[model samples]
Target: MTSTPDVIRGIVGVYHADGGLRGELAYLIGKARGTAHCGLCDVTHHALGRRREWRELVAALGVPVELVHLNERSPAVRAASEGRTPCVLAVTDAGHRPLLGPDELAEVDGDVARFATALRGAADRAGLRWAPDER
Candidate 1:
């Protein structure tokens, strides 16, 4: 049987513009019952954990990542379905596309190393920052 962590690493799903992913993350954490907490750090940790789990699963299972948009589909969707991991959907007035930040692009060039690099690059490009857990 697959462990919880292993199961977490194999899920692939779509994120809608209406904050579906965030909502799903919250739901997942909430389902943990006593394990869930009201503290900010706790919430953030849970969310990040979910995100990491999703990413790992997509990578391990070769699952496609997709983004929802009006009319046309995002290139990232195509790339993801084509077996690209760590793909991003950038919503734009023109349309969405599969995009990688410098780090993500760099990571794609190699193997597993690309995951961290791409994540860092994507965070940098998105003006977001991630810190390791205190534990």
Candidate 2:
């Protein structure tokens, strides 16, 4: 977890149980449906930074990731994606924006690490912070 206070840019709110991400992140999670398949899926199930790459991402972004299982999501949840699955979204005070789709992440046959790195870059640009557990 980051040594600095959980507040990112002075935005104060509750965090999710997965890590200590801002409460607003939850809304974004709820808006999306369908968890993207990644190398860390089996281990972390529904988290953003379950693996090493993701850890670095969370550390950088300072927020916890909540992955929704698209295959398992009901039609209602699918509405959030508007039929776009396996895409990265950046949530902000204005609204959410699409970063990439599964097609973009799939690098030379499901290179999840490469995809993660790309996501890390995007999150980094968005000022996301990394929040690791007590290690």
Best by TM-score: 2
State the displacement of the C-alpha of residue 95, model 1, in Å, after optimal TM-score superposition: 9.5
Tens digit of lDDT per residue, candidate 1, span 22-134?
A: 65466456647644322212211243354454346344433233433222334545444244332344332223333452334433442434444554455456543322222
lDDT of 1 at 89: 41
Candidate 1 lDDT score relative to the true structure: 0.36
- lDDT of candidate 1 at residue 70, scale 0 to 100: 20
lDDT tens per residue, model 2, 1-135: 324432222111111122225433543565355332332233233345445544554455544444554444334334445555555555443334445554554441334456556665655666664333333
lDDT of each: 0.36, 0.43
